[model samples]
Target chain A: DVKVTQSSRYLVKRTGEKVFLECVQDMDHENMFWYRQDPGLGLRLIYFSYDVKMKEKGDIPEGYSVSREKKERFSLILESASTNQTSMYLCASSLLDRSNQPQHFGDGTRLSIL
Target chain B: AQTVTQSQPEMSVQEAETVTLSCTYDTSESNYYLFWYKQPPSRQMILVIRQEAYKQQNATENRFSVNFQKAAKSFSLKISDSQLGDTAMYFCASEHTSGSRLTFGEGTQLTVNP
Candidate 1:
């Protein structure tokens, strides 16, 4: 089974604090993604990386950034936490294939900003 | 750009009964993929089913199956013999065959009643 591990299941941060969410995959997949899930908005893409040391902004990347320094690791960074940024964050990975494979996901990190 | 749409915000079904969740997508690409994902209270996003655009037959996984209508740009999920564990938020998503990103729609909250 493919494993996507997020560092934390729940996290709390104060406003103006920097926060990091870590994710690691054992499947050697080349593509990784970060998303925030809200009640009505669903999952909005925050960032995605297709290769090590490469990153691309997604639909809602304004306050988020990603780092993929290794094929197995992807990190999401929030420069400064805010109450509005609190949400369930998810990490996922997929193989670098043209067949459109399904992404494997982690349990997620529910971040709370106060 | 691709877009996914899930019109149903909430749905309920009795245990052992069947329920279908609807999804629609708009894209200009000829080849792509569609998916249905289930997120339980644990908040782990699980891949429920996948459908390739070129496949004429819908995809099925045990009690879960999909009704993929390519021409109509529709992909719906059918859950049979539903159980309490089947209750979750179901999300519809689309991905291009060669793209590394996925587009997700607003989710449908499913409740399984005894």
Candidate 2:
């Protein structure tokens, strides 16, 4: 079984603070993703990394960035946390293969910005 | 941009009964994949089922199945003999064949009553 682990299950930050969310996958998948989930607006991709040091902006990448210094770890950075940024964040990983393998997700981190 | 839609916001069904959740997507890309994901209260996203756009037959997994209509761009999930454990937020998503990002719809909250 594949295991994806997020560093924090619940987080709180003040406005204008820098926040980091960490994720690690044991499967060594080549693709890692960060998503923000909000009510009435499903999960939206924030950023994704296909390989170490390679990152791409997803549909809603504003105010957020990602780091993939190693194959097994991906981190999401909130440049300046705002109240509107409070939401559940999810991390997922999948093998970059032709089989179209589904992504395995970690238990999300619910972030609250004060 | 690909857009996935789930019209049903909330649904309820009794244990041992069946329930269907509807999903539709609008995308210009012909080659893509559709998926249904379940997020329980534990906040873990689990892949329920998936269908390739090129496949004519719908996909199924045990008591869960999907009705995929390529021309109409509609994919719906049906859960047979629903159980309390099946209660969760169901999300519909799509991914282009050339990309790894998934576009998701506002989820449907499902509750199985005893």
Candidate 3:
């Protein structure tokens, strides 16, 4: 079974703070993704990395960035956390194959900004 | 880019009954994939089922199955003999065969009453 582990399950931060959310996958999948899930709006992609040191912006990438320094770890960074940035964040990984494998997701990190 | 839509925001069913969640997608690519993911109270994204555009047969797993209509770009999930454990927020998503990103629907919150 694949395991995607997020460093924190619940986190609280003050406004204007820098927040870091870490994710590690045991499957060594080539693609990693960061998404923010909000009520009614569902899950929206924030950023994704296809390979180490390569990142791409997703639909909702403002105020968020990502790093893939190693194949097994991906980190999501909020430059300046705001109250509106508080939401459930999910990390997922999948094999970068043409077969279109399903993504395996972590348990998710629910961040609260005060 | 692909777009997934789940019109029903919430649904309910009694235990041992059956329920179906609807999803529609719009994508220009002929080769694509569709998926149904369940996010339970635990906040873990679980892949319920997957369907490939080139396949004529709908995919099924245990009591979970998908009704896939390639021409209409519709993919719906049917849960038979639903149990209390089936209660969750179900999301429908789509991705191109060659692409790395997934477009997800707003999600349908399904509640199963005992």
Candidate 4:
């Protein structure tokens, strides 16, 4: 089974603090994604990395950035945490294959910004 | 941009009954994939079922199945013999054939009563 491990299951940060959410997938998938799931808005993509050092901004990537220094690890960085940024963060990974493979997601990191 | 919508905000069904969750999407891209994802209270996103735009037959997985109407741009999920474990938030998502990003709907909360 594929396993996506999130560094933190629960996190609390101040408004101006810098936050980092880490994700590691054991499947060595080539594509990794960061998404923030909100109550009524659903899961909005923040950023995605198709390969090491290659990242693309998604619809809701305004206050977020991503890094993929290695194939197994992907990181989501909140430039400065804001109260509005408080939500459940999910990390997903899928193989960059021609076949339609499902993206496996981590348990999720519930971040609370005060 | 592709947008997904789940009209039903909440739905309930008896343990032995069946329930269906509706999903509609707007997209200009002809080649794409539609998916239903289940997010339980544990906050983990699990892929329920997926349907390819080109496939005429709907997809099914055990007790879970999809009613895909390509021309109507509608994809609904039906859970047969509903169980308490089926209680969760069901999200409809779409992904373009050329891209890996998934656009998700607001989600419909499902409850299976005994």
Candidate 5:
């Protein structure tokens, strides 16, 4: 079975602190994504990486960045955490084949910024 | 920009009944994909079903099926014989064929009453 592992299931950070959320997938997928889910707002894409060292900004990319140094690992970075940034963070990965591939997601990390 | 919308914010259905959740999207791109994802209380986002835009026939997976109306830009999910385990937050998402990013709807909180 494909497994997507998140580094933390829950996290708390102070305002102005730098935070890192890690995601690793064992499926050898080529596409990885980071999204923040808020109540009544659904999941908004923050960033995505299609290949190692390649990244693209999504709809709500401000205050967030991504790093994909290896094929299996993708990281989401919050330059300066703020209370408004508190939400559930999700990581997903999918195969490179565009035909009909579905993304596999990890158990999200609930981040609380204070 | 591609946008997904779920009109229902909350839905409830009795066990062993059928329920449908509505979703609509706006995009000029003809080639794209639609997905229904379930996020249970466990906070794990799971892919429930998917439909390719070019496919004329609807997509079905066991008790879960999608009514895809390409011209109407509507993709609704029908859950037959709903169970208590089916209770979750259902999100409709769209991804363009040219890119890897997905746009999600506000999501519908589904409660399966036993």
Candidate 6:
């Protein structure tokens, strides 16, 4: 079975603070993604990394950045957290194959910005 | 750009009953994949079922199955003999076979009343 682990299950941060959400996958998948899920709005992609040091912006990438220094770890960084950023963050990983690979997700981190 | 839609925001069903969740997507690509994911109270996103657009047959997994209508671009999930453990937020998602990202629906909150 594939295991995707997130660094934090819940987090609280003050406005204008820097925040980091980490995700690690044991499957060594080549593609990793970060998404923020909000009520009514659903899950929107924030950023994704296809390989080490290679990142791409998803639908809603503003105020967020990503780091993929290693194959097994992907990190989501908020330049400065705002109240609007409070939401459940999810991380997922998939194999390099794009044809028929399904993404495996980690337990989400619910971030609260005060 | 691809977009997924789940019109029903919330649904309820009695235990041991059957329930269906609807999903629709709009995309110009002919080759793509569809997925249904369940996120229980634990906030872990688990893949429920998947379907390839090229396949004419719908996909099924035990008590979980999908009604895929390619002409309508609709993919609905049916859960038979639903159990209390089946209560969760179900999200429908789609991805182009050539792309690395997925487009997700807003999600339907399913509650199984015992």
Interface RMSD of 4: 1.1
- Give the C-alpha lDDT of model 6: 0.95
Candidate 1's C-alpha runs over 4 A off are A98-100
User: Where does candidate 6 stray beyond 4 Å?
Assistant: none
User: Candidate 2: lDDT of A65?
Assistant: 89
* Residue runs of model 2 more than 4 Å from their true location after superposition: none
Model 1 chain B: weakest 10-residue lDDT segment is B94-103
Model 1 lDDT vs. the true structure? 0.93
**What TM-score is obtained for chain B in each of the predicted models?**
0.98, 0.99, 0.99, 0.98, 0.99, 0.99
TM-score of chain A of 2: 0.98
Query: How do the residues A24-57 of candidate 2 rate in per-residue lDDT, one tens digit apiece?
Result: 9999799999999999999999999999999999
Off by over 4 Å in 5: none
lDDT at A79 for candidate 2? 95
Better of 2 and 6 by DockQ: 2
True contacts kept of each: 0.74, 0.89, 0.79, 0.87, 0.89, 0.71
Clashing residue pairs in candidate 4 are none
Candidates ranked, most accurate by DockQ first: 5, 2, 4, 3, 6, 1
Any runs in candidate 4 off by more than 4 Å, and if so which?
A: none
A2-90 per-residue lDDT for model 4 (tens digits): 99999999999999899999999999799999999988888999999999999999888998888899999999999998999999999
**Chain A TM-scores in order:** 0.97, 0.98, 0.98, 0.97, 0.98, 0.97
Query: What DockQ does candidate 1 have relative to the true complex?
Result: 0.77
Better of 5 and 6 by DockQ: 5
Tell me the number of clashing residue pairs for each predicted model.
0, 0, 0, 0, 0, 0
Candidate 1 lDDT tens digits, A38-106: 998889899998889999889999877788899999999999888999999999998888464689999
Tell me the DockQ of each model, to 2 decimals. Answer: 0.77, 0.86, 0.82, 0.84, 0.87, 0.81
Q: Which scores better on lDDT, 1 or 3? A: 3
For residues B1-114, what per-residue lDDT tens digits would candidate 3 score against the true structure?
A: 788999999999999999999999999998888899999999989999998889999999999999999888899999999999999999999988878898999999999999
